[model samples]
Every structure is written in structure tokens, then in C-alpha cells.
Target: MPTVKPRLSKQHQRWVMPTLVALVSGILMGLTVAPVEAWFLAWIALAPLWVLVLFPTQRLKLLIPLVWGIGYHGVALAWITGVHPMMWMGVPWLASIAIALFCWIAITLWGAVLVTTWAVCMTVFSRGVGTFTRVLIGVALWCGLESLWSLGPLYWSSLSYTQSPHNLVILHLGQISGSLAVTGAIVAVNGLLAEAWIRYQGSGIGNRGLGKSYKAAMRLFASSCLLFVALHLVGFGLYSRPLVQPPQAALKVGIIQGNIPNTIKLYPEGLRRAIAGYTEGYITLADRGVDAVLTPEGALPFMWSEALRTPLYSAVQQKGVTAWIGAFGEQGQSYTNSMFTLTGDGEFSRYDKVKLVPIGEYIPFEQILGGLIHRLSPLEAKQVPGSPDQVFDTPFGRAIAAICYSSAFPEQLRYQANQGGQFILSAANNAHYNPSMPAQHHAQDTMRAIESDRWAVRATNTGYSGIVDPHGKTLWISGLNTYELHAETIYRRTTQTLYVRWGDWLTPLLLGLAVVFKLTSIQASQK
Candidate 1:
């Protein structure tokens, strides 16, 4: 006898199409970001999502966006899984896998929560509004949420980054109001598309005469296309404007990519290898007559006092070239992830990392979850955060330092630049994760470079060491997992971009506009 397959319940059946549509939209949005980098898709990626949120038939409107966020973040952050196999960190194999999976899922859900929040706001604000008001509210809410998220712990996945390192025109908008302006433009275009499509569906085009709705839909679609072109044209004008560099000696900076394995980087054997490798690279670059040499974050993999005993210390003294090295620094009973600037004359300054990774550097709710799983850090003690006002005074010039995860925060770098930091020095250790992680990290650095209108010199363990010009172009970059040394000429410019002066001004303006529109809509309904 043949058995009948179990069917989904009526309630569950109602979710099938909406979930599929939301997922497709989310996946498209994810592809527009790094790794896949199908940036052209970003303009239309949100149309399906907008349609679902703008015209909801189901009672659970938030679920659509939550699922969409899961799909989007799941694809964008798939690289988080590369942290698995923490057996190197003394975690059991199965437990290590569970930890990695937990991190990925937890972060994804958190990101999804943000998306759902936006959906909730959009639904409330756009009710009883015309297409134009809907578009404005959509852009406002997106930019506002992105700005708010920047204030939170994690901020790697901003909408503006979708155009980075690929679409130079759109990226140029960052100079005006930082990445928020670019984000606004992106959401504006996507919102218009969604509005056009919604209007088209309601137009009933099969009628003999094209009704007002059909004409309105066509006009809206055309207006969106025009607005998209106009945004690009304005961006092109910004990109075309020449960035005049101050007349100063070009600093020849040498970058050392020490290919250290994360598993043994803290071990005695791995520590020895790191010392030898960086010492060799430092000496080689010094012999080449570089102004300074840079090593990846945690290149020494030990405390500052311990690093003093390594050959790298003696090498820096003998070589006489200024060196910016990443290592652990001790303060009282706490340790900090810091970047040390050592000049040939023995002058040294330290900038402790301001932003620490949530679970990787310090555990949240440590009182509750402390014993459950180990933090991803190699150090036993909790790492302390540095003052946000810290900037490195190097022999070359005042420089902004972004240590590892701190690179994702643009406002910190902008503040440093505003405080007379002429250039950016980003040191990272991407040895633990896959190539995608470093690439995404590199993209973020490029965005910061463009926004600040400063040259950025980046050094990383294992690969992607490079220099980016003020225009967000990669002047030099290295291959993944390769031990390489490169030197490039980067300028120290004192000219501050508009973004450096204003600092995310557009975010608040957009949010305020959203509030005004919502209030107006409610007032109109009452009348």
C-alpha cells in the first residue's frame, strides 16, 4: 500500500511564497557585498523585500524581514564559520564546531533583528502614504538604522559598502557625509524601484485605456531611472575633483606579511617563528631604506616586555628604521591589544586598540557565560580597551591606527584624521579565518580611506597587504596566505574631507526627516 506524505498545515502553507521571495531578495542583497561582489544587483535587490513590507497580507509582517535578514546575513557572513576547529585553542573538536556555529547563527540573528526593526518602522510610517513618501521613509529608515548600528559592537555590513572598491562614483559620495550618504543614495534608488513595481502591479494594464495608475507607474519607473542616473552623475563630479596633496616628502612605507598559523601563533614554537620571520622582513625592509616598517597585528604574539627580549627588538635598534609593530601591552593587571611605534632613536609611542571584538576579545555577560565557552582570544586575561582619542605620532606623521576589528568603525578613524592624522595605518591578523574575511576587511579599509581622503597603508598576516589612495583605489595588494614584503610611496595629507569635519551628519538629518514624515502622516489621518 502507498503511504500519503505528511502535508504542511494551513498556517504554515501561507508562509511558503513570502518566505521564498524574501529569501531570494536577501540572497541578492548579500551577493552585492564583498566576496561575490555583484554590485550591480544592489539597486533592485530590495524591490521584492519592499513589496512584501509595503503591502503585507499576512498578519506576521515582521517574520518576512526576519527570514530575509537570516538569508542575507547568512550569505554575507558565511566566513565566520572559518573560525571552527578550535582544537588549536584547546577546545574539543565537536565543541569547537558548536562554538563556531553558535557565533555565526547568533550574529546572523542579531543582524536579522535590525532588519525586522526597520520593517516594523516602515510599515508604521508608510501606511496611508503615497509612493513618494514611502520612498523617502524607506531611505530615511535605512540610513538611520545603519548609523545606529555603527554605534553598536558589530558594524561590518553597512549598505554603503555594497558599492565599495568597485563603483568609484557611488563611493565618492562618502566624502560628503561619510558612508551614510552613499547608503542613503543606495536605499533611495532601491525604494524607488520597489515603489514603481508596486504601482505597476496595481495598474491593471490589460484595460483598453491606460488608466491613471498605469501612467503613474510608468512615470515613477522613469523617475527612478532618472534619479539613479543623477546620483551617479553627482558622484562622478565628486570623483573627478582632484585631491591636492600637501607638498611633503613621500613616506616610503614597508609592509611585512608574516604568514603565521593561528593554531600555534601563541605557542613557544610559533612565537619563535613569528619573531624570526618579522625580524627578517624588518631587516630586509630597513636595508631597502624605508622610512618605517609595519607588521601585522599581534606579530609578536606576546607582551611588550617579552617582545623586548626577542631578536626583533635588537633588530629594530640596529636597523634604525621606525617600526610600527603589533603586540600585547600590559597595564596593571589587564592587557591591551596595542600598536607600538618605535623610532630609530628608541622613541616609542603606543596606541591601544579602541574597539574589541565581542566574543573574540572579551566575553559579554561574562558572569553568566564565562565558564561555558572560552573566548577566541589567546590571552588568558581580559583585554582592556584603549581611549578613543588615541592616535600614533610617528616619525612620518600623525597617523590613525586601526588594529584588527577596529577598522570597521569609520567614525573613530575620522576623528583621528580630524585630529591631524595625515594617513591611516591598519594592522590585522587574518591568519585564523578564510580569505573572504580578509578581503571584506580590506574593503572596509578602502571605504575609510575614501571617506577620510587619506592614503591607507594596510599590513596583514598571511595576505592582502596593500596601499589605498585617497580615491579608494588599491595602489598595491598581496596574494592570500603568502609571506611577502612590499614598499610603497604614500603621502601624508593634512586636507580633511567634509566627512571628517561633519562626521555622520546625514544620519541624524535622515532620521529626523523620517520622524517628521511619520508625524505628518498620522496628523493627516486624524484630519
Candidate 2:
């Protein structure tokens, strides 16, 4: 019989095919998941990417992670283009796409490196261990990523957040190790499946060992899932019990999503509508018996200052509630992105956003690039940054307020709880982020809730306006492509988790270890 031609053969097959497979699998993974059903398929989706990473070839190994990362981030985050122009209008449409794509590339490269690192480390450790221990250690290795370095900016797009809609039980476990706990399980499952496949395709000489390993891994995975489900059942029991206590002391909160188009946020006409939409939404929430209503970041078209407090304070007082609104606080030629709180009696406090978006909020290399870069690019020269480490006091309790991007960084949330913040409040404008981003963004709140053991209220303009519990479970979420209101219960959690007390100290230590290991390995190879 004639020799059969291999579908993927030689060097081209080794690198190109694996990368293509990884990318395709990544797309499938994204498609398989949604805001609510993220947890179930989290492991399955990553299996292909993990499989590519497991391949032993040097070139295929390098390209596999990079390509997989491209597909993973590119497909998952393509939704940012909708709102980029609002932040910076000078950049042409194509330039905005380029920037978004470029950012995705950076994210992808980082993800690939992380994934490759994980794969390499797992293989190195799995040499002679039983399958279950291997999986357990692998999971630890994966979860250990969250504790390694300031890693949130690189890999916080968690599988649990994607699964929040369908599996409330699964999401609740985040109370233990934060969301990264479940994320680690998901990655380990993917690792288990991918490694099993390789064993199946390999020679029979390793059959007994392979069978034992696969069997052990499956057992561990099954137990893990069952345990996760059991934990959810326990959370449900707690949730079903009397949660809205002191019913008479309820505070009405109105969260506004102005739905203002980004292109016009800075324009005079656009600013008028922006104010109208926010004020109108504020009116609606106020009339609904809200003791305090919140508008999304930069809700007002104009600058936020002690001067604008005149009308805003009067209106808030008239409404018989507090107004927590996002706007620009101007001083001289400088501007600050801020969230201002106005009480029913004209009392005021403001939390300016501290974790500013590096390029989006201000130019990083202005001295080197000169002002010409501003005209060439969409970014503004400087948007005043706020010292938002403090908590804002209200009639209820001390609430930690984190503006849009600030919420993504866990340290800010940890600091809030450490400083006696009884509750966490996040105001965002999803007009720039995709539905996926909101899903991921909202999920991060659960981790913060778990760490601090506090209730989180997330209100956004565009989509995913909702509330989360101390365990990282969502109470309610607003619908997309339309205006909606959600009345979710929230309470203060006096207790805190281990992560909260230590903050990100563990993350840096782990990252340092990984770097040292990589360096040592390089030295050994040279010898």
C-alpha cells in the first residue's frame, strides 16, 4: 500500500499546526463561555492551549504559546473598539483598532509566556509522581500564579467570572482562596486532559504508568468538582437564609448608566446629553426611594469641583438621598477623574481614582515624545490623578470606592478593607469594554469581596451593572443594550481573609521564586 501522507508532518507541521490548533481551540473556548457559564467550560476551553504547550519540540513550543495567546486575547477582547474613540477622539478609527490590537498583542505575549512557563514547570515536576499528586501540584502551580508577582494586570481574566451566571455554587468557593482558587482548578483540569491525550498517543512502553496517571488524575478532578459543587450548596443554604436583615434600615441606592456615546463625552453637545442622561437616571433612581444613587465614571459632561456642588448638592438634597457621581474635577488647566459623593443634606466627600490607566488617562513618555504625541495620538497629556486610598463615609458605613480601572487592581480593594472600609463600591463606564470585559471585571469584585469579606456594589454605564457578596457570588446584574435597574441586597462583612491581611506580599514572593528558578535553570543549561 502507498504510504499515507501525514496531515501535519515535519517542521511546518510541528510549529504551525500546533499554533493553529491552539488558536482555534482558544476561539472555541471563548465561544463556549459566557458571562454566567464561565466556570463549567473554563478547563475544557484551555485544554487545547495546554495541549499545545505540552508538545516537546523547541520551535513548536515557543510559537505555540504565542499563537495561542493571540487567539485567546484577540478573540476574547475584540469588543473594546466600541468605546475607545470616546476616551480619545483624535486617533482615527484605524488607529484605535491598531492600539486595541496592539494592547491585545502585549496581553497575548504575556499570557503565552505564563502558559509556557506553567507547562514547562508542570512537566518538570511530573517526572515520577502519581497522577493525582501531579494534578494537585499542577493546580497549586497554576493557583500560585496569582501569588506570583503583580500578576493581576496580566491574567485576571478568570474562568470563574465567565461561569458566574450558570454556576452560583462554583463562584462562591472563591471565598476561600479568592477567584484564583477556582481558576487554578480550571487550569489543572486542562493540564490533566492535555497530558492524558499525549499519553494516549505515545508508545505502549509507558502504558501502565500512563494508565495509572490518567486514572489518578480523573479521580482527583472528579473529587474536586464534587467538592466545589458541595461548597456551592452550602453557600446556597447561607444565601437562602435571612440575608436582608434590619429590613427597616434599608438604604435605597440608584445606579445610573447614561448610555452616552463615547464620541460626544467631550463634545459640547455630547456633554449636554451626558449630563441629561445621568441627571435623568439619577432622578429615576431617586424617585425609586434610593437613599443614595451612583452614576458611572465621568458621568457629567463638565468638570467636578467644589463649584458644581451648588446645583448638584441642591438636587441631591431635594431628592432626599446621596449622589455618588463620576466626573472630572478641574483645577486651573489640570483635570482629575473623580467620584464625588453628595449627601441628602448637602454634605460632600470625594474619592478620586488612584489607579489611573497608564496611557489612556495620561501620556507616560510626554517629556520624550513632546506635545506632538498628543496631537498624533488619542491620549490626553494629563488627567489629574486622585489619592483614592481612603474610604468615603456615608450614613450607613465606610464604603471603599474604586473608580472603573481601579477596581481591577486587588491591592486597592485590600487597602480599602484594611482601612475600615465596611463595603466596596465600584463605578464604571462599560461603554468602552465588551460584554466579556464586564463579565471578567465584575468577577474580580467577587475576589475582592472574598478577600475583605465585604459586600460589593458594581454600577456601570453600558452593561453588567450588579452587586456581589463577600463570597464572590453575584446577586443581580443589569441587562445589556438597554437601560435597567437592579435592587440587590448588600451587607458589611467584619471578618477578613488571609489574602486581605497579607495583601499582595505572597504574589511578589512567588514571582521572585519563579524568576530565580528560571535563572538557575539557565545557568545549569550553560554548564
Candidate 3:
């Protein structure tokens, strides 16, 4: 008797294969970011999911993108577990494990929901649309969703970040079109590949249309190749434009990292050590002939009044170099994470942090849910958010400063740039997070530098501090968990990039167009 082969049922074909493909696709997409950083993979990462949506199946298309979002976010955001883990927050061990898992899963699911919603919307809108139209819809929907998320409080990662600050050549695309342009280009390529794939497979299987399918596949493939080449060429043109910084007027800035361990960062004894550590670090840099010394966030580890009363203020006053210090500033019942600038003649200016990290710095809707969250976690002492429009007037130049979490929002920085921010200044306390967090955070700042066309001086406590030029190249970067000072002369440019001028106006416009197209497609289908 001949061996008999069992055929796959409709349910297995529709559900099992699509689900597995979506899962694998999401994982690969996630790998294109930090901890793995296989950026080239981003070109093809969405192909599997894109292909899945092309064919007919009883399987819910919504579930395909949902699984992808879960995979990508689950891996990309794994470091969330390390951010003030439940045990560190004084919860019981078993409960701590459960809490950490819950937090991670919650964040992953939230991101997944946003992504899956986009997929569903795209599927509905893309009915009867050609491959090219589908690609445009995908790009528009993705950009629109990112813009929507950015308008909210929890803006973290974007698809363009997958390319990273390392890919200097292509990253210049950000200067012209911002991160959305890079993301759109990547999606378009994925769509092209998916279209080519469907057609090619149909030809191979000879499903009653071999000749036509092969020709269509060849055209799509050729178009994808042409687009790939054209994008790189455009990138090269943008990259070739020199960002001319005034070499003669370059500010010699010094940065310090105190290497404070997270275990003792906020304790009484640790606060004393932090003051001493940063004082010494500041003196060390001032002695090295720096024109200005920049310190990390919470370097003083005390209230503004106490910081002024300390010997460190006298040291800075005597050193005669401009000093920008990050410390806690208090006003009555409110506390702000502020950056204070002390000139040689004792003139002072302060820029408070506007964007507070939810649940970490300040709990949202604390009036209603504060009591409940307090019982669940020991989070107390909320840091009040500062004015979004404050700019620091430094002796070196008029600068804009983003403290820690504020760096994640590009529009805030763009607004500052529009307000005559010569060069960007960022100070951070990354002492409590994992190494991966800082790397990813640092990458976000790099995009800001490129987007605004300004030199960025980033000072962080306990790692990944560096000077990024207007071109988004890391001129100098410090190692993680190390105490050190980097002294370099950074060029301050006044020129603004396209992103700074128009901001993200293009994305919202595209989003509106997407809605119109979707509604029109539905109407046409009915007709």
C-alpha cells in the first residue's frame, strides 16, 4: 500500500500558519532595535505579516498584527522589568515577580493594541486598492498612529529608531522628513516585497494565471529595487549637506558622570556622597580649562536652597567658568527636577523639566487613584512638571535643556529650536535603569540632534554620556556605569533643519487623508 499524506484542514490553514508567521514577524521586527540592533532586518521584518494579509483566510487579520506587536514589544521593552523592580520597591519576592511580569505584559499589550489597531484600519481601508496604494496606506497609517501616540504621555519607541544613530548615511533622511520619512520608506519596501512575493508564488503554483502573475511579480520587484536605490541617493544628498558650525566660537564644554550606584542613590548617606562626588568631578573638569562645566541630573541630590548654600556653589563662583548644574528645586509644596545655570558673575537661570515620567516621577490622576497606587507600590514624592517653554540663557549661548524623560518628545525640542535654541543640552539620571535603557535613550537624543541640526551635549550620571554633532554622529561617547569627565569643544550651530520649521505637520495631514481614503474605499465597495 502507498503511503498516505494527511491534508491540512481549513482551520489549520487559516489560523495556525498565519498566527505562527505573525509571531515570527514581530520578533524579527523587535530585533531591529536595541539589544539586538539588526537594523537591516527592518526592511524585511514586516514582509511576513504583510504577505499574510494579502491572501484570503478565515483567520482574523487583526490577530496577525496583534501577535506581531506583542512579539516586537515583548522583546524591545524587556528592560521594563529592571526599572525599579517590585522587590526593589519593597514588595514581597513572589509578589514582586508577579508585579514585574504584569507591568511588562501590560506595556507590551498596550503597544500591541496600538499596532494591531493600525493593521485593522489598514485592512479595512485597503480593500480593492492596488499594491502601490496599499503601500501608501500602510505608511500613512503607521505614521498617523505614531503621531497620535506622541501627542499623549507615553511616547517611547518609533520604527525609524531601528535604523539608529550608527547608520549615519541614511539617518540624514530625518533632517528633511523627520523619523516618519524613514519609517515610511521602510514600510513601502516591505509592501513592495509582499506584493512581489504574492505574485511570484502564484506564478510558481500555476493557479490559472502563471504568465500574468510572473510579469506582475517582476514589475513589483523592479519597482522595489528602484525605490531602494532612490532612497539611498536622496539620503546621500541630505548627508552631503555640510552643517557649518562656527569653529572659532565653539564652546569648550566639560561633562561629568559620578558613577553612583542605584542601590544608594536616594538614601540619606548616599545624598551626602553624591554632593561630594559631583563637587570633585566639577572641580576636576574646571581645572582642565573648560569654558563651561555641565553636570548630570540630580548630581547635587539636594534642594535648590541647600545646593546654593553648599561649598560647591562657592567653588563654581570662584572657578569663573559657566556652570550648568542639575538638582532638585522646591517651591512651597511642589518639587521640580530643574537645571540651574550659574555664571561666573553669579547670574542665574533655571529650566525645569516639563515632561514627567508617569508612575516613575509622578503618578497620573493622583487625586483619584493615588491612595490605591500607594498601597500597591511605595512610590511617593511626586516631581512637579515645569513650564514647557522655559529656555536656559547660558554664558556660552542661549541653550535649550531637556532633562531625562523630556528627551523622548521631539516636538518639545523642536519648539525650543524654533525659539532660538543654538545648541541642545540634555542632562539625565540613568542610574536606576538597565544598560539597554540608556543606549536606547541616547539614540533618541541623537535623532533630536539630527532633526534640529544642532550640536547636542548630553550629560548622564552613571553612563552613555556624549557629544553629538549636528550630523548625528557621536563625536565622543562614555562607557556605562563609569565615573569620568569628557572635555571637548562642541560647535554651536544656529541653522534649523526642515523638521524644526514644519514640525510633524505632514503626518497628521496624511492621517486625515488615510481616513478619507478608507471611507471612500468602503463607499466604492458598496457601489
Candidate lDDT (C-alpha), each? 0.86, 0.62, 0.80
Backbone clash count, each prediction separately: 0, 12, 0
In model 1, how large is the Cα lDDT of residue 271? 86
- State residue 105's C-alpha deviation in candidate 2, in Å: 2.7
Ordered from best to worst lDDT, the candidate numbers read: 1, 3, 2
Per-residue C-alpha lDDT of model 3 across residues 1-527, encoded as one tens digit per residue: 13332344555776887898889888998887777888888888887878886665435778888898998888877877775444544556776566467668877887898888888877777878767777778889888888787777777767788887677667777777677777777888888988898888778665535488888998998988889778889888877787666567689999988777766666776777777877787788899999888888878766788888877788888888788888888866868888999876774788999898765676667897465345342224557888777777877678979898888788888888888898888999887667888888888899888888888999998888999988888999999988888899988777877888888766777667766776777777789
Tens-digit lDDT string for candidate 2 (74-167)? 6555554444553356767666666666566655566556656766676675444544455555666665654552344344444445555455
Query: Model 3 compared with the native: what TM-score?
Result: 0.92
Candidate 1: residue 263 lDDT (0-100): 84
The C-alpha RMSD of each candidate to the native structure, in angstroms, is: 2.5, 5.1, 2.9
Give the TM-score (vs. native) of candidate 2. Answer: 0.79
- Candidate 3: minimum summed lDDT over ten consecutive residues — where? 1-10
Q: TM-score per candidate, in order?
A: 0.95, 0.79, 0.92
